[model samples]
Target: MSKYTTIAIFGLIAISAILYTYFFYFKIEERLPIYQPSQINPALVDPSLIAEKDHRISDFNLYNQLGDTVSLSDLEGKILIVDFFFTRCATICPILTSNLKLIHDRLPDGVHILSHSVTPVADSVSVLAAYAEKYHADPSKWWFLTGSKDEVYRLARTSYFACLDEGDGGYQDFIHTENVVLVDPSGRLRGFYDGTKEKEISQLYLDLATLKKELSKIN
Candidate 1:
């Protein structure tokens, strides 16, 4: 081939390679959707908190297992996973905690997990401390939280939409569910998983990794 012809052929080969990389190797990941109050099952959300769109987790002031106060602001700029359970739960709670432990082990720094006690009347700070210890949870990375029964249940049903039970968090009220909710650094609800199922937990890990990649592109 002539010199100009050889140069033209090389340019075409380089252009083809770049296009192939962009189309096949460099994929733009689809981010998890930001869940809105209306998108959630109507029964799971408190009637007062439901909005047309762009519903974010409400602020909360609750105590972790160490009796230290924790709030939504404390978790600002951090990815979070949240779940609701009681220390006394004997059925699926244990499985959920174990699966969460797996995520906690693999999660990147600045990622945190919050577990709220549904039966806070019985699960005092001491009880929560023991539960956290039992799970070998890292206090800084994973928090076992306890608060007023009413406040906890209100957050569960209104802010997180984590349970389907209906009640006022009164004396006879109790909430139970297997959901593990994923929240972004901006406090948006991104996804939900069945905490008791291994397959769901695996999917959560994959989604978490995708979230990490998404955040990296922005930063």
Candidate 2:
């Protein structure tokens, strides 16, 4: 090949490689998968919603640690990190709360944590208040919620899909899951992680950053 032709070919190859790298990284980093009921495990999803494609979390009314009524509307423009936990559990719940506290301390103002009490009947507003205090939870950033067991369980099964076993949220029914769910500002399910696992927590952090960038584009 002629000298000029060889140099031109090499330059073109270098430019092509740069473009490929740039596009590939941004494509992967800029988008997170929007989860739906059909995409989640069947056990986690209510049977009626197993085939539904455009599912978003349903509206809920729950009391926070301070006895303030919090509804889904109140969190309309914020990214949510949600989990189900009870204060009296001897297994997994403490670790979940501690790890979540790490996230709470590091997350920006736009992100909020909602720890719903699965045993809300026993976990009154005062009980949740003490639990929040134990974790040094910021009332503004992290909310420990309690309300009707039926409503909370309905959210767990139909909305967030955070657990596997099914129940009616009755007196004998109970749910215990370590799943940590991520919701976008618009209430779409984005991701799920094992709350007790460090690797999963790290992945949650990375996904949160990516979601923040994705939201930036829209706003």
Candidate 3:
């Protein structure tokens, strides 16, 4: 074949390869699916269910600061503001926890705050207890949880519907956002906030108060 013919054949192959890869291998979700409890079951399921449920975070058994299991079911009747962080984190974790403390302080009795450690292996009950003390975490009110690497990642992504990727560091690694998840008394997700921002978290507090007003009628 002539040189021009060979060049033309190469260009076509490159285009075909690009098309194949685009269609088969590269699927990225721009945003997580929003899950409302009302959409739990249906005959013809909505297409968003898988995405939503996959990103939804729930209580898998995790050890709290005192080494007790704080299962998702255990939080069924109370309002919970959950987030992810690790004690050893030199970046965003401290800011998130300090902001959470403000929320914990303002929330009326019966409301709870939970922070799950993304560094699961390094944050066993004893390790987390030391970290919690550093934050002055009140075990009766705020719970700093630590568990297996798999369980923590599951909670961060599936339970809390926040980004905490293991790919950033392998099984012992986690990638995350500064998110504070607000779950209503009925286990329904109510709101989310940027844990690093005081204004946003303060707004979360106001929203929590509004939720408190509504939940009180049932109490």
Clash numbers, per candidate: 0, 0, 7
lDDT of 1 by residue, 1-88 (tens): 8999999999999999999999898876688888988788888877776764777788999999999998899887899999998888
Top-scoring candidate (lDDT): 2
Candidate 3 ranges beyond 4 A from true positions: 1-57, 164-173
What local distance difference test score does each model get?
0.89, 0.92, 0.73
Per-residue CA lDDT of candidate 3, range 40-84, in tens?
A: 333222334444433334448888989898787776677788888
Ranking by TM-score: 2, 1, 3
Q: lDDT, candidate 1, residue 19? A: 94
TM-score, one value per model: 0.87, 0.91, 0.71
Alpha-carbon RMSD, each predicted model: 3.7, 2.5, 16.8
**Where does candidate 3 clash, by residue pair?**
56-158, 56-159, 57-158, 57-159, 57-160, 58-159, 59-72
Reference-based lDDT, residue 68, model 2: 99
Best by TM-score: 2
Which residue segments of model 1 deviate by more than 4 Å? 1-27, 47-50
**Candidate 2 lDDT, 121-177, residue by residue in tens:** 889999999999999999889999999999999998888999974778899899999
